[model samples]
Target: MKPFLTGHEELIHDIKYDFYGKHLATVSSDQHIKVFDLDSTTSSWILNDSWKAHDSSILRVSWAHPEFSSSKILASCSFDRTVKIWQEQPDELHGSGRRWSKLVTLAIESYAPIYDVVFAPNHLGLKLGCVGSDGIFRIYESVEPSDLSQWALTSEIPILNSSLPAKSLQSSFAIEWCPSKFTTTEKFIVVALDQGFIYGTKPGGGKDDLQNSPRQQSPLQQQLEQQPQSQQESRYIKLGNLPEHNGLIRSVSWAPSMGRNYHLIATACKDGYVRIFKAIETAKGDLKIEILAKLNDHKSEVWRVNWNMTGTILSSAGDDGNLRLWKCNYLNEWKCMSVINTSNRSDNRGIEVEPK
Candidate 1:
C-alpha cells in the first residue's frame, strides 16, 4: 500500500485489479484513468496509457474481459449521461501491448449518467451492461468496426421487472452477474438497487439502437398492429430481503463457486458496514440465503466491496479514505486481512458527480 500516485483534483471512484492481482486500474473524478503495475520496483509504475475520457466526472471503470488473458476491452460510465467503451491496442496504442484508448460512446437521456459497467463473467462473444442516473440498464455489444470506437446496443433492459414500479427505483448503483451456472437454462444477471431490491434478469433482446440508431416506421395502420394478448413476461427471479445495511446498499459482488449451495454474496452500504451472505437450503427444499458475517470496521460509508477472482479475498473502500482487505475464515466469517488508510483526502468512490 505505498503511495502509488499523488495530487489529483477529484476522488477515486473505482479500483480494479487484474485476475492475477498483478495489475491495478483506478478511475478518478479528475477525469483521468491510470493503470499501475503491482510488480513495479521503482514505486512509480509506467503510465501505460490515458486520455480525457469523459465530458464530466467519471463514475466507474470496468474491465470488460477476464484479467491478464483477454482483458483488451475497457468500459467506463460517467456523470455526463453517457457510457464509453475503450480498447487496449497493444501493438498500436502502446508498444508493450497494454495501452487503452476510447473505442465507442453511448449517449442516453441527458443527465441520466451511467454509474457502473461490467462484462458478464465467463461469457464469450463480448458484451457488457451499464446502469446509472437514469435508472435504466443498457447492454452493449463488441462488434468489430472499421473504427473501433463504434459499438452497438445488443440489448436494452429499461426495467428488470414489470412488478417493480419503473420510475420509482431506476437509479441502480450496483449490479453483478450470477456465476456461470454451467446449465444454460438459468442464465441470469443480478442487479442491486437503491430501494432495497436484488433481482435477476436474462437478456431478452434490444429495444432500439442507441448508437447510430435507425429511423422507425409507424406501419400500425396497415397491419392493425397484429394485436396480441397480454402474455406474462417473467424473466426475473426475486431473492429476498437484503437490508443488512441500514441505508442504501452501495455495492454487491459474488464469489467464484459453481455448486448452488456453495455461493456467497457480499454488499457494502451507506450504513458503514460490509455484510456477507451465503446461499441456504430451506426445509421446504428451496434455496435461500443466510448472513455469514458483517464487517463494521469501516468508520465511514462503505462505498464498495469486491471479491478477488478466488472470492476468498475481499477489498472495500469508502468516503473515509480507508481501503480494507478481508479474508474469510473456515467458519465462513471474514476477518480483516489488510487496510489502506488514505485519510485526510476525500475518497474517489464518494466524490463522484452524476447529472440529474
Candidate 2:
C-alpha cells in the first residue's frame, strides 16, 4: 500500500470515503477536517480543502449519498457538543476547484458531546441520526433540499431505561441506520451505548401513525407507561436490546443489504472483541437478532468496525494499532482474512518506519 503523509498534528479519530470513493474526509483530535480528492490521471490523492471544524476533537464524519443532490454533502460530530453540515461548492474563478462550506450546525438540546452522526440511506429523505453523551438519540430531517439549514428535529428518544435512575444512564458511543427498509414505510436505527448494551429503535410516524402501528412493546415503552399521562406520547419505539458485551461498546455498523433475507450488524467493544449479529424479521414482522460471530483477534480495545460496500467483507481497527479484515467462508463462518499493522518501528539508520 502506498501512503501519503496527512500532516495532522493530532490523532485522526475518523476517516470516511464519499459515496463513489472519489473523495476522502478525515477528522482529527486537532479539531480540523480535511478533504482529499483522488486524481484519476495521476492516481494520487490531492488535498482539496482543509479547515478547523470544531472546538474539540472531531469524532466522526459521514457523507450523504450523491443521489440526494447535484453537489455532495457531509455531516460531522465532535467532542465540542455540536454537529455540522457541510456542502461542496464549485469555485468558479478557479476551474476544477471545489471547496466545502458550512451549511448548518446542530447542537443537542442538552448540549452533550455527540459521538457519532450518520446520514440515512438515499431512500430516506435527507435524514441524519446522532447519538451523544446525553443518552439520547435524535433524528433530523431536511424538508427542503434547497435549504439544508432548515433541519427539523423529527424524533427524539431517550435511549436509557427510564425506570433506572437518571445517574445510571450511560452515554451512547455509536449509531448506525439500517440500510435496508423492510417496507417503503419503515426505518431502523441501531445504537451502541457505553453501558455495554446495544439497542435498536424505530422512529415513529411514517406512512402509518404510531397508534395504528403494530410492534412489540419494548423496554423503553414499558418504562414510559409507568410515568404520567403527559409523558406517554413518544415518536420512537425501541425495537430491542442485544446481549450485553464484556465491556463498553465503541462502534457499531450495519451492513448494506444486498437482496439478503437477513441483515448483518457488527459491533466493536473496549473488550478487544468484534461481534457480528444477524437481524432477521420474524413472522410477526418484528426484528429478532442473534449473535452470528464473536471474533477476538485484537489484543487491545477495538475502536471501529465497518462493512464493505458489498456487505461481504468487514474491517476493524483497534488500540493495538492494527486493522483487520474479516470474511465469511462457505460454511457461513466468519474469520479474519488479513491484518494491517499500524505501529511504528525503528530501522537500521535510526529512522522510524511507519506502516503503509
Candidate 3:
C-alpha cells in the first residue's frame, strides 16, 4: 500500500472513495476535509482540495453516486451537531481547476453530535441517512434531484430497543444501507450501536404513519409533521434487533447484493472479533437475519470493516494497527486470507522504520 501525507494536525477519522474510485475524501478530528484525485498517468494520488468543514471534529464523510446528479456530491457529519453537503464545481477563476463548495447544512433538533453519515444507492434518488449521539436515526431526501439545497427530513426514528435502558445507549453509532440491486422500491438499513446491539429498519411505507404516534416520535419527527402533507408522509418502521455483541460495535457494512437473493452484513466490535450476518428473503417477501460467522482473528478492538465493490472480499482494521482480509471458500466459510501489520518499528537508535 502507498501512503500519502494528508497534512492533518489531528487524527483522521474516516475516509471514503467515490463510486468510481477516481476520487477519495478523508475527514479528520482537526475539523478538516481533504479530497484527492488519482492521477492515471503516474498512478499516484494528488491533493485536489482541502478545507475546514466544521467547527468541531468531523467524524465521517460519504460520497454520493454521480448518477444522482450532474456533478459529484459529498456528505459530512461532525461533532458540532451538523451534517453538511458539498458539491464539486469548476473553478471560474482558475482554468482546469475544480473546487468543492458547501451546498447545504442539516442540523438536528436534538443538537447531538453526529457520528456517521451515508448516502443511499443511486436507485434511491438523492437520499442520505445519519445517526448520532442522541440515539436518533434520520433520513433526508432531496425533493428536487437537480437542486441539492432542497432537502426534506423524511423520517426520524429512535434506534434503542424497547427492552434496552436509555442509559445503555452510547455516543457513537454506525449505519449502512443494504445495496440490493434487485429491489427498487424497498430499502433496508442496518444500524450498529456502540452499546453492543445492532438493529435493522425499513423506513417509509404505505401504512407506516407517524401522525398518531407523537409519544414515540423524535423531536425532528414531530417538527416535520407540522410541515405540508407531502413532506410529512414518510415514516420509519422497525425491523427488530440482531444478535447482541459482547462489546461495543465500532462499524457495520452491508455488502452489495449484486442480484443475489440474500444480503450480507459485516460488523466489527470492541471484543476483538468480526461478525457476519446473512439476511435472506422468504417466498412471502419477509426478511430473516441469521449469524453466518464469527471471526476472532484480531487481537485488539476492531475499528472498521468494509467490503469490496463486488462484495466478494471483506477488509477490517483494528486498534492493533493491523489490517486483515477475509474471503470465503467453496464451503462458504470465511477465512483470513492475509494480514497486514501497520505498526512501525524502531531501531536501537530510536529511528522509526516504515513497514515494507
Q: What is the TM-score of each candidate against the true structure?
A: 0.70, 0.82, 0.83
* Candidate 1 vs 2: which has more lDDT: 2
Q: Give the alpha carbon lDDT tens digit for every residue of 1-356 in model 2.
A: 23677768999888899988898899999998888888888878878777788899999999998876787799999988899999888752222333677888985574678888998776655778887777677777675566767676656667766432244554446777777655423445555454433333333443223333222221233343364532332434555466658877888888988889888888888888899988776554466879899998887888889999889999999987778999999999999998776656644443346657
After superposing candidate 2 on the true structure, give the runs of residues whose Cα lies further than 4 Å from its correct spot: 92-98, 162-172, 181-185, 195-205, 208-233, 345-356
Task: Output the TM-score of candidate 2.
Answer: 0.82
Ranking by lDDT: 3, 2, 1
Clashing pairs in 1: 11-348, 12-348, 90-97, 103-149, 135-170
Q: How accurate is candidate 3 locally (lDDT)?
A: 0.73
Error of 1 at 258 (Å): 6.3
The better candidate by lDDT, 2 or 3, is: 3
What C-alpha lDDT values do all the predictions have?
Answer: 0.60, 0.73, 0.73
Which residue runs does candidate 3 get wrong by more than 4 Å? Answer: 92-98, 161-170, 190-234, 283-285, 345-356
Clashes of 1: 5
